[model samples]
Target: MSTPKKPTEAKAKPGEGVSRRGFIRDVGLGTGAVGVALSPTAALCAPPALAGPGPVPVTLTVNGKQHKLELEPRVTLLDALRNYLDYTGAKRVCDRGTCGACTVLLDGKAVYACNILAIEAQGKNIQTVEGLALSPEPDPLIRAFVNNDGLQCGFCTPGFVMAAKAFLAENPNPTLDQIKRAFGGNLCRCGSYNGIRRAILEAAKSAQGGGKNA
Candidate 1:
C-alpha cells in the first residue's frame, strides 16, 4: 500500500484567528473569572487602581461660617452643605439643576446649589435656609410659612423659604403674580403652590410693614 500522505497543518489566514473585538471580550471574561477565583486575601494584596481623582482642599463660606473641607473637585455645593457641613436645609432633589429644591443664595442671588461646585462657591456669600432663621427670634419668613400653611410634607419647605427670602429681599412688596413668577423655578410636589405664594406675599407685606402680621 502506498505510504499515507503526510498530514498537513493548516495555517490561519493573515486576518483570521480571534478578531480584536473577540480577543478583548475573551480577555475581559477571563480576567473577570480570574478575579472571581482569587481569594479575598490575594485580591487585597493586589494593588488597586484609582477610583477617581484625588481629593483637593477646598474652603467654602456657608451661612456666614467659613468651612474648610478636603473634597474632590467634582463635589457640588449641595453635597458640601448637606454631606460635609451638616446643613441639610437644602434638599438634594432634582440634582440635575432642574428642580430648585437645592436653591440657595450665592452673592444674594438665588442659585441651584446642586448646579454649583463647592470650589465655585468659595469666597462668596452662600445663604442657605438654615441661615434664614439664625436670629434669636424666629424670622418673619419662617413665621409666614407656618402661618399661611405653606407646606405639607415639608421636604420642599426649606427651598421655598430660601427662594421667598431672596425674592422678598429684592422685591419686598411683590404682588401675587410677581410672587408666583419669583418662585417659578421652585416646585412643590405637595401641590401647595397657592399657600406658598400666599406665604411669600404675607412675608413681603410683613417685611414692608415691619413684621406685625408676618
Candidate 2:
C-alpha cells in the first residue's frame, strides 16, 4: 500500500530484558557460590587461635608483711598494692610514671609503682606511706609535713612523703637547692612546693636532734 513498507523492529516484552535487580541478584549468587567453594580451603589455611598469659602465683613483701596472691604477670605494682592489698596510699594519678603520685620505695629507693610490675617486685623491700606510721608516734617526716602544711587536697601527699623519705635517707642534710633539684621528679597540683621544702628541712633538723627518721 505504500512505496515499500519498512520492516518494523520488535520491542522487548515486559520482564524480557536483563534488569538491575536481576543482575544484582545473579552477581550475589555467583559470589556466594564462590565463597562456599573456597570456605573449606580458607578454614584449613587459617592460623590457630592464640590466647594471652593467664594469672600466676605472685608473692609480695609489702610493709614488712608477706602477701600471697594470684595475679597476672602484667599487673602493675600500684594496682596490686591498691586493689589487692588495700594499700591505697599511692594515688592512681598520671599512671604513666609521671606526676609521681604513685611513688613507693623499692629496696630503699624511690620508684614509681605504676612503672614496676607486681611479679617483678617479688622479694624486694617495698615501703609505702602506710608503712611509715607503723609506730605509735607518726614518723618525724610525716609530723613535719603536717606541721608545715605541706599538702592540700592530699592526693599527692603520700608520693611526696615517700620521695622525700628516700631523698633524706640519701642526703640527710640536704640544702634548699639540693631539695629543689631532687624533688624535680615529684609535682604538686596544689602548688605547695614552698611548704614541702620547709617540711623536708625541718624533718632533717629533727632527725639531727635524735628524732627517728622512720
Candidate 3:
C-alpha cells in the first residue's frame, strides 16, 4: 500500500494562515478543556485555609469548667472541643453544620459547634454531650438514648443528645412538632432520625414526672 500523505505545513501570509487558524483553535480548545477539568479539582486540592489571623488566647467555659486556650481565631468550636479540649463527644462529621454531628448547647440552646467560632462561645455556658450527666449518674436522655438504640455508629448521637437536652431544658413537655423543630438543625447520615425522635419523646416523658429534661 502507498504511504499516507502527511499534512502540509501552511505558510503564513502577512495577516493570515491556515496553520495560525488551526493553532488558535487548538489553543483555545486546549485551554478551555484544561480550565473545565481543573476548576473543581483545583478547588479540592486547595489547602485547608484558616479563617483569619493566628491563634489567639481565648477562655471558654466547658461543662461548668473554664479552659484557657491559645488557638487560631478561625478555629471552630467543634475543633476547640474535640482537638484542643479532648472532648470528643461532639463528632466532627460534616463540619459545616449540615450533619449535626458537631452539636452542643450554648446557654441551653442547641448550637452546632462547627458553625460557631470558639471565640464566639465566650461568656456563654457551653455544654456538650458529656455535660448531660454532670450531676446525675445516668441522665434520663442518655438512658432513653441507650434504651431506644437511638444511635447507630454513634456519630450524630452527641449532637442529637445535646439538642435533645437543650430541647428538654426549654420545653420539658414538648409536642412532637416542638421536638422536631428543636432537632431541625441536627441531621443524621445513618437515617436514625426516627430513633432520635423516639428517644427524645421518651426522654421528655421521663422528664415530665420529675425525671430529667423531659
All candidates' lDDT scores?
Answer: 0.74, 0.79, 0.73
Q: 97 in model 2: Cα distance from truth in Å?
A: 0.5
lDDT of 3 by residue, 1-214 (tens): 1121221211111112236677777556645654754688755666765232334577889999888877656568887787677788988776677878788888878888889988889999999888767775789898888888898888788888887887778787877666767777877777887788888888888767743433
User: For every model shown, what is its TM-score relative to the native structure?
Assistant: 0.73, 0.74, 0.70
What tens-digit string does per-residue lDDT give for candidate 1 at 80-141?
Answer: 77767778889987788877899999999999998988777889999998887778988888
Task: Flag regions of model 1 displaced more than 4 Å.
Answer: 1-52, 210-214
Clash pairs, candidate 2, are none
Order of the predicted models by lDDT, top scorer first: 2, 1, 3
For each candidate, C-alpha RMSD in Å? 19.5, 24.1, 18.5
Please give the ranking of all candidate structures by TM-score, highest first, separated by commas.
Answer: 2, 1, 3
Task: Name the runs in model 2 displaced over 4 angstroms.
Answer: 1-52, 210-214
Q: Quick one: RMSD of model 1?
A: 19.5
Model 2 Cα lDDT, one tens digit per residue, 22-117: 666755664565475468876576566411123567788988988887665656889778767778898888878989999999999999998998
Q: Which 10-residue window of candidate 2 scores lowest in summed lDDT? A: 6-15
lDDT of 3: 0.73
Q: Give the range where candidate 3 is weakest over 10 consecutive residues by summed lDDT.
A: 7-16
* Selected candidate, larger TM-score, 1 vs 2: 2
Question: What's the TM for model 3?
Answer: 0.70
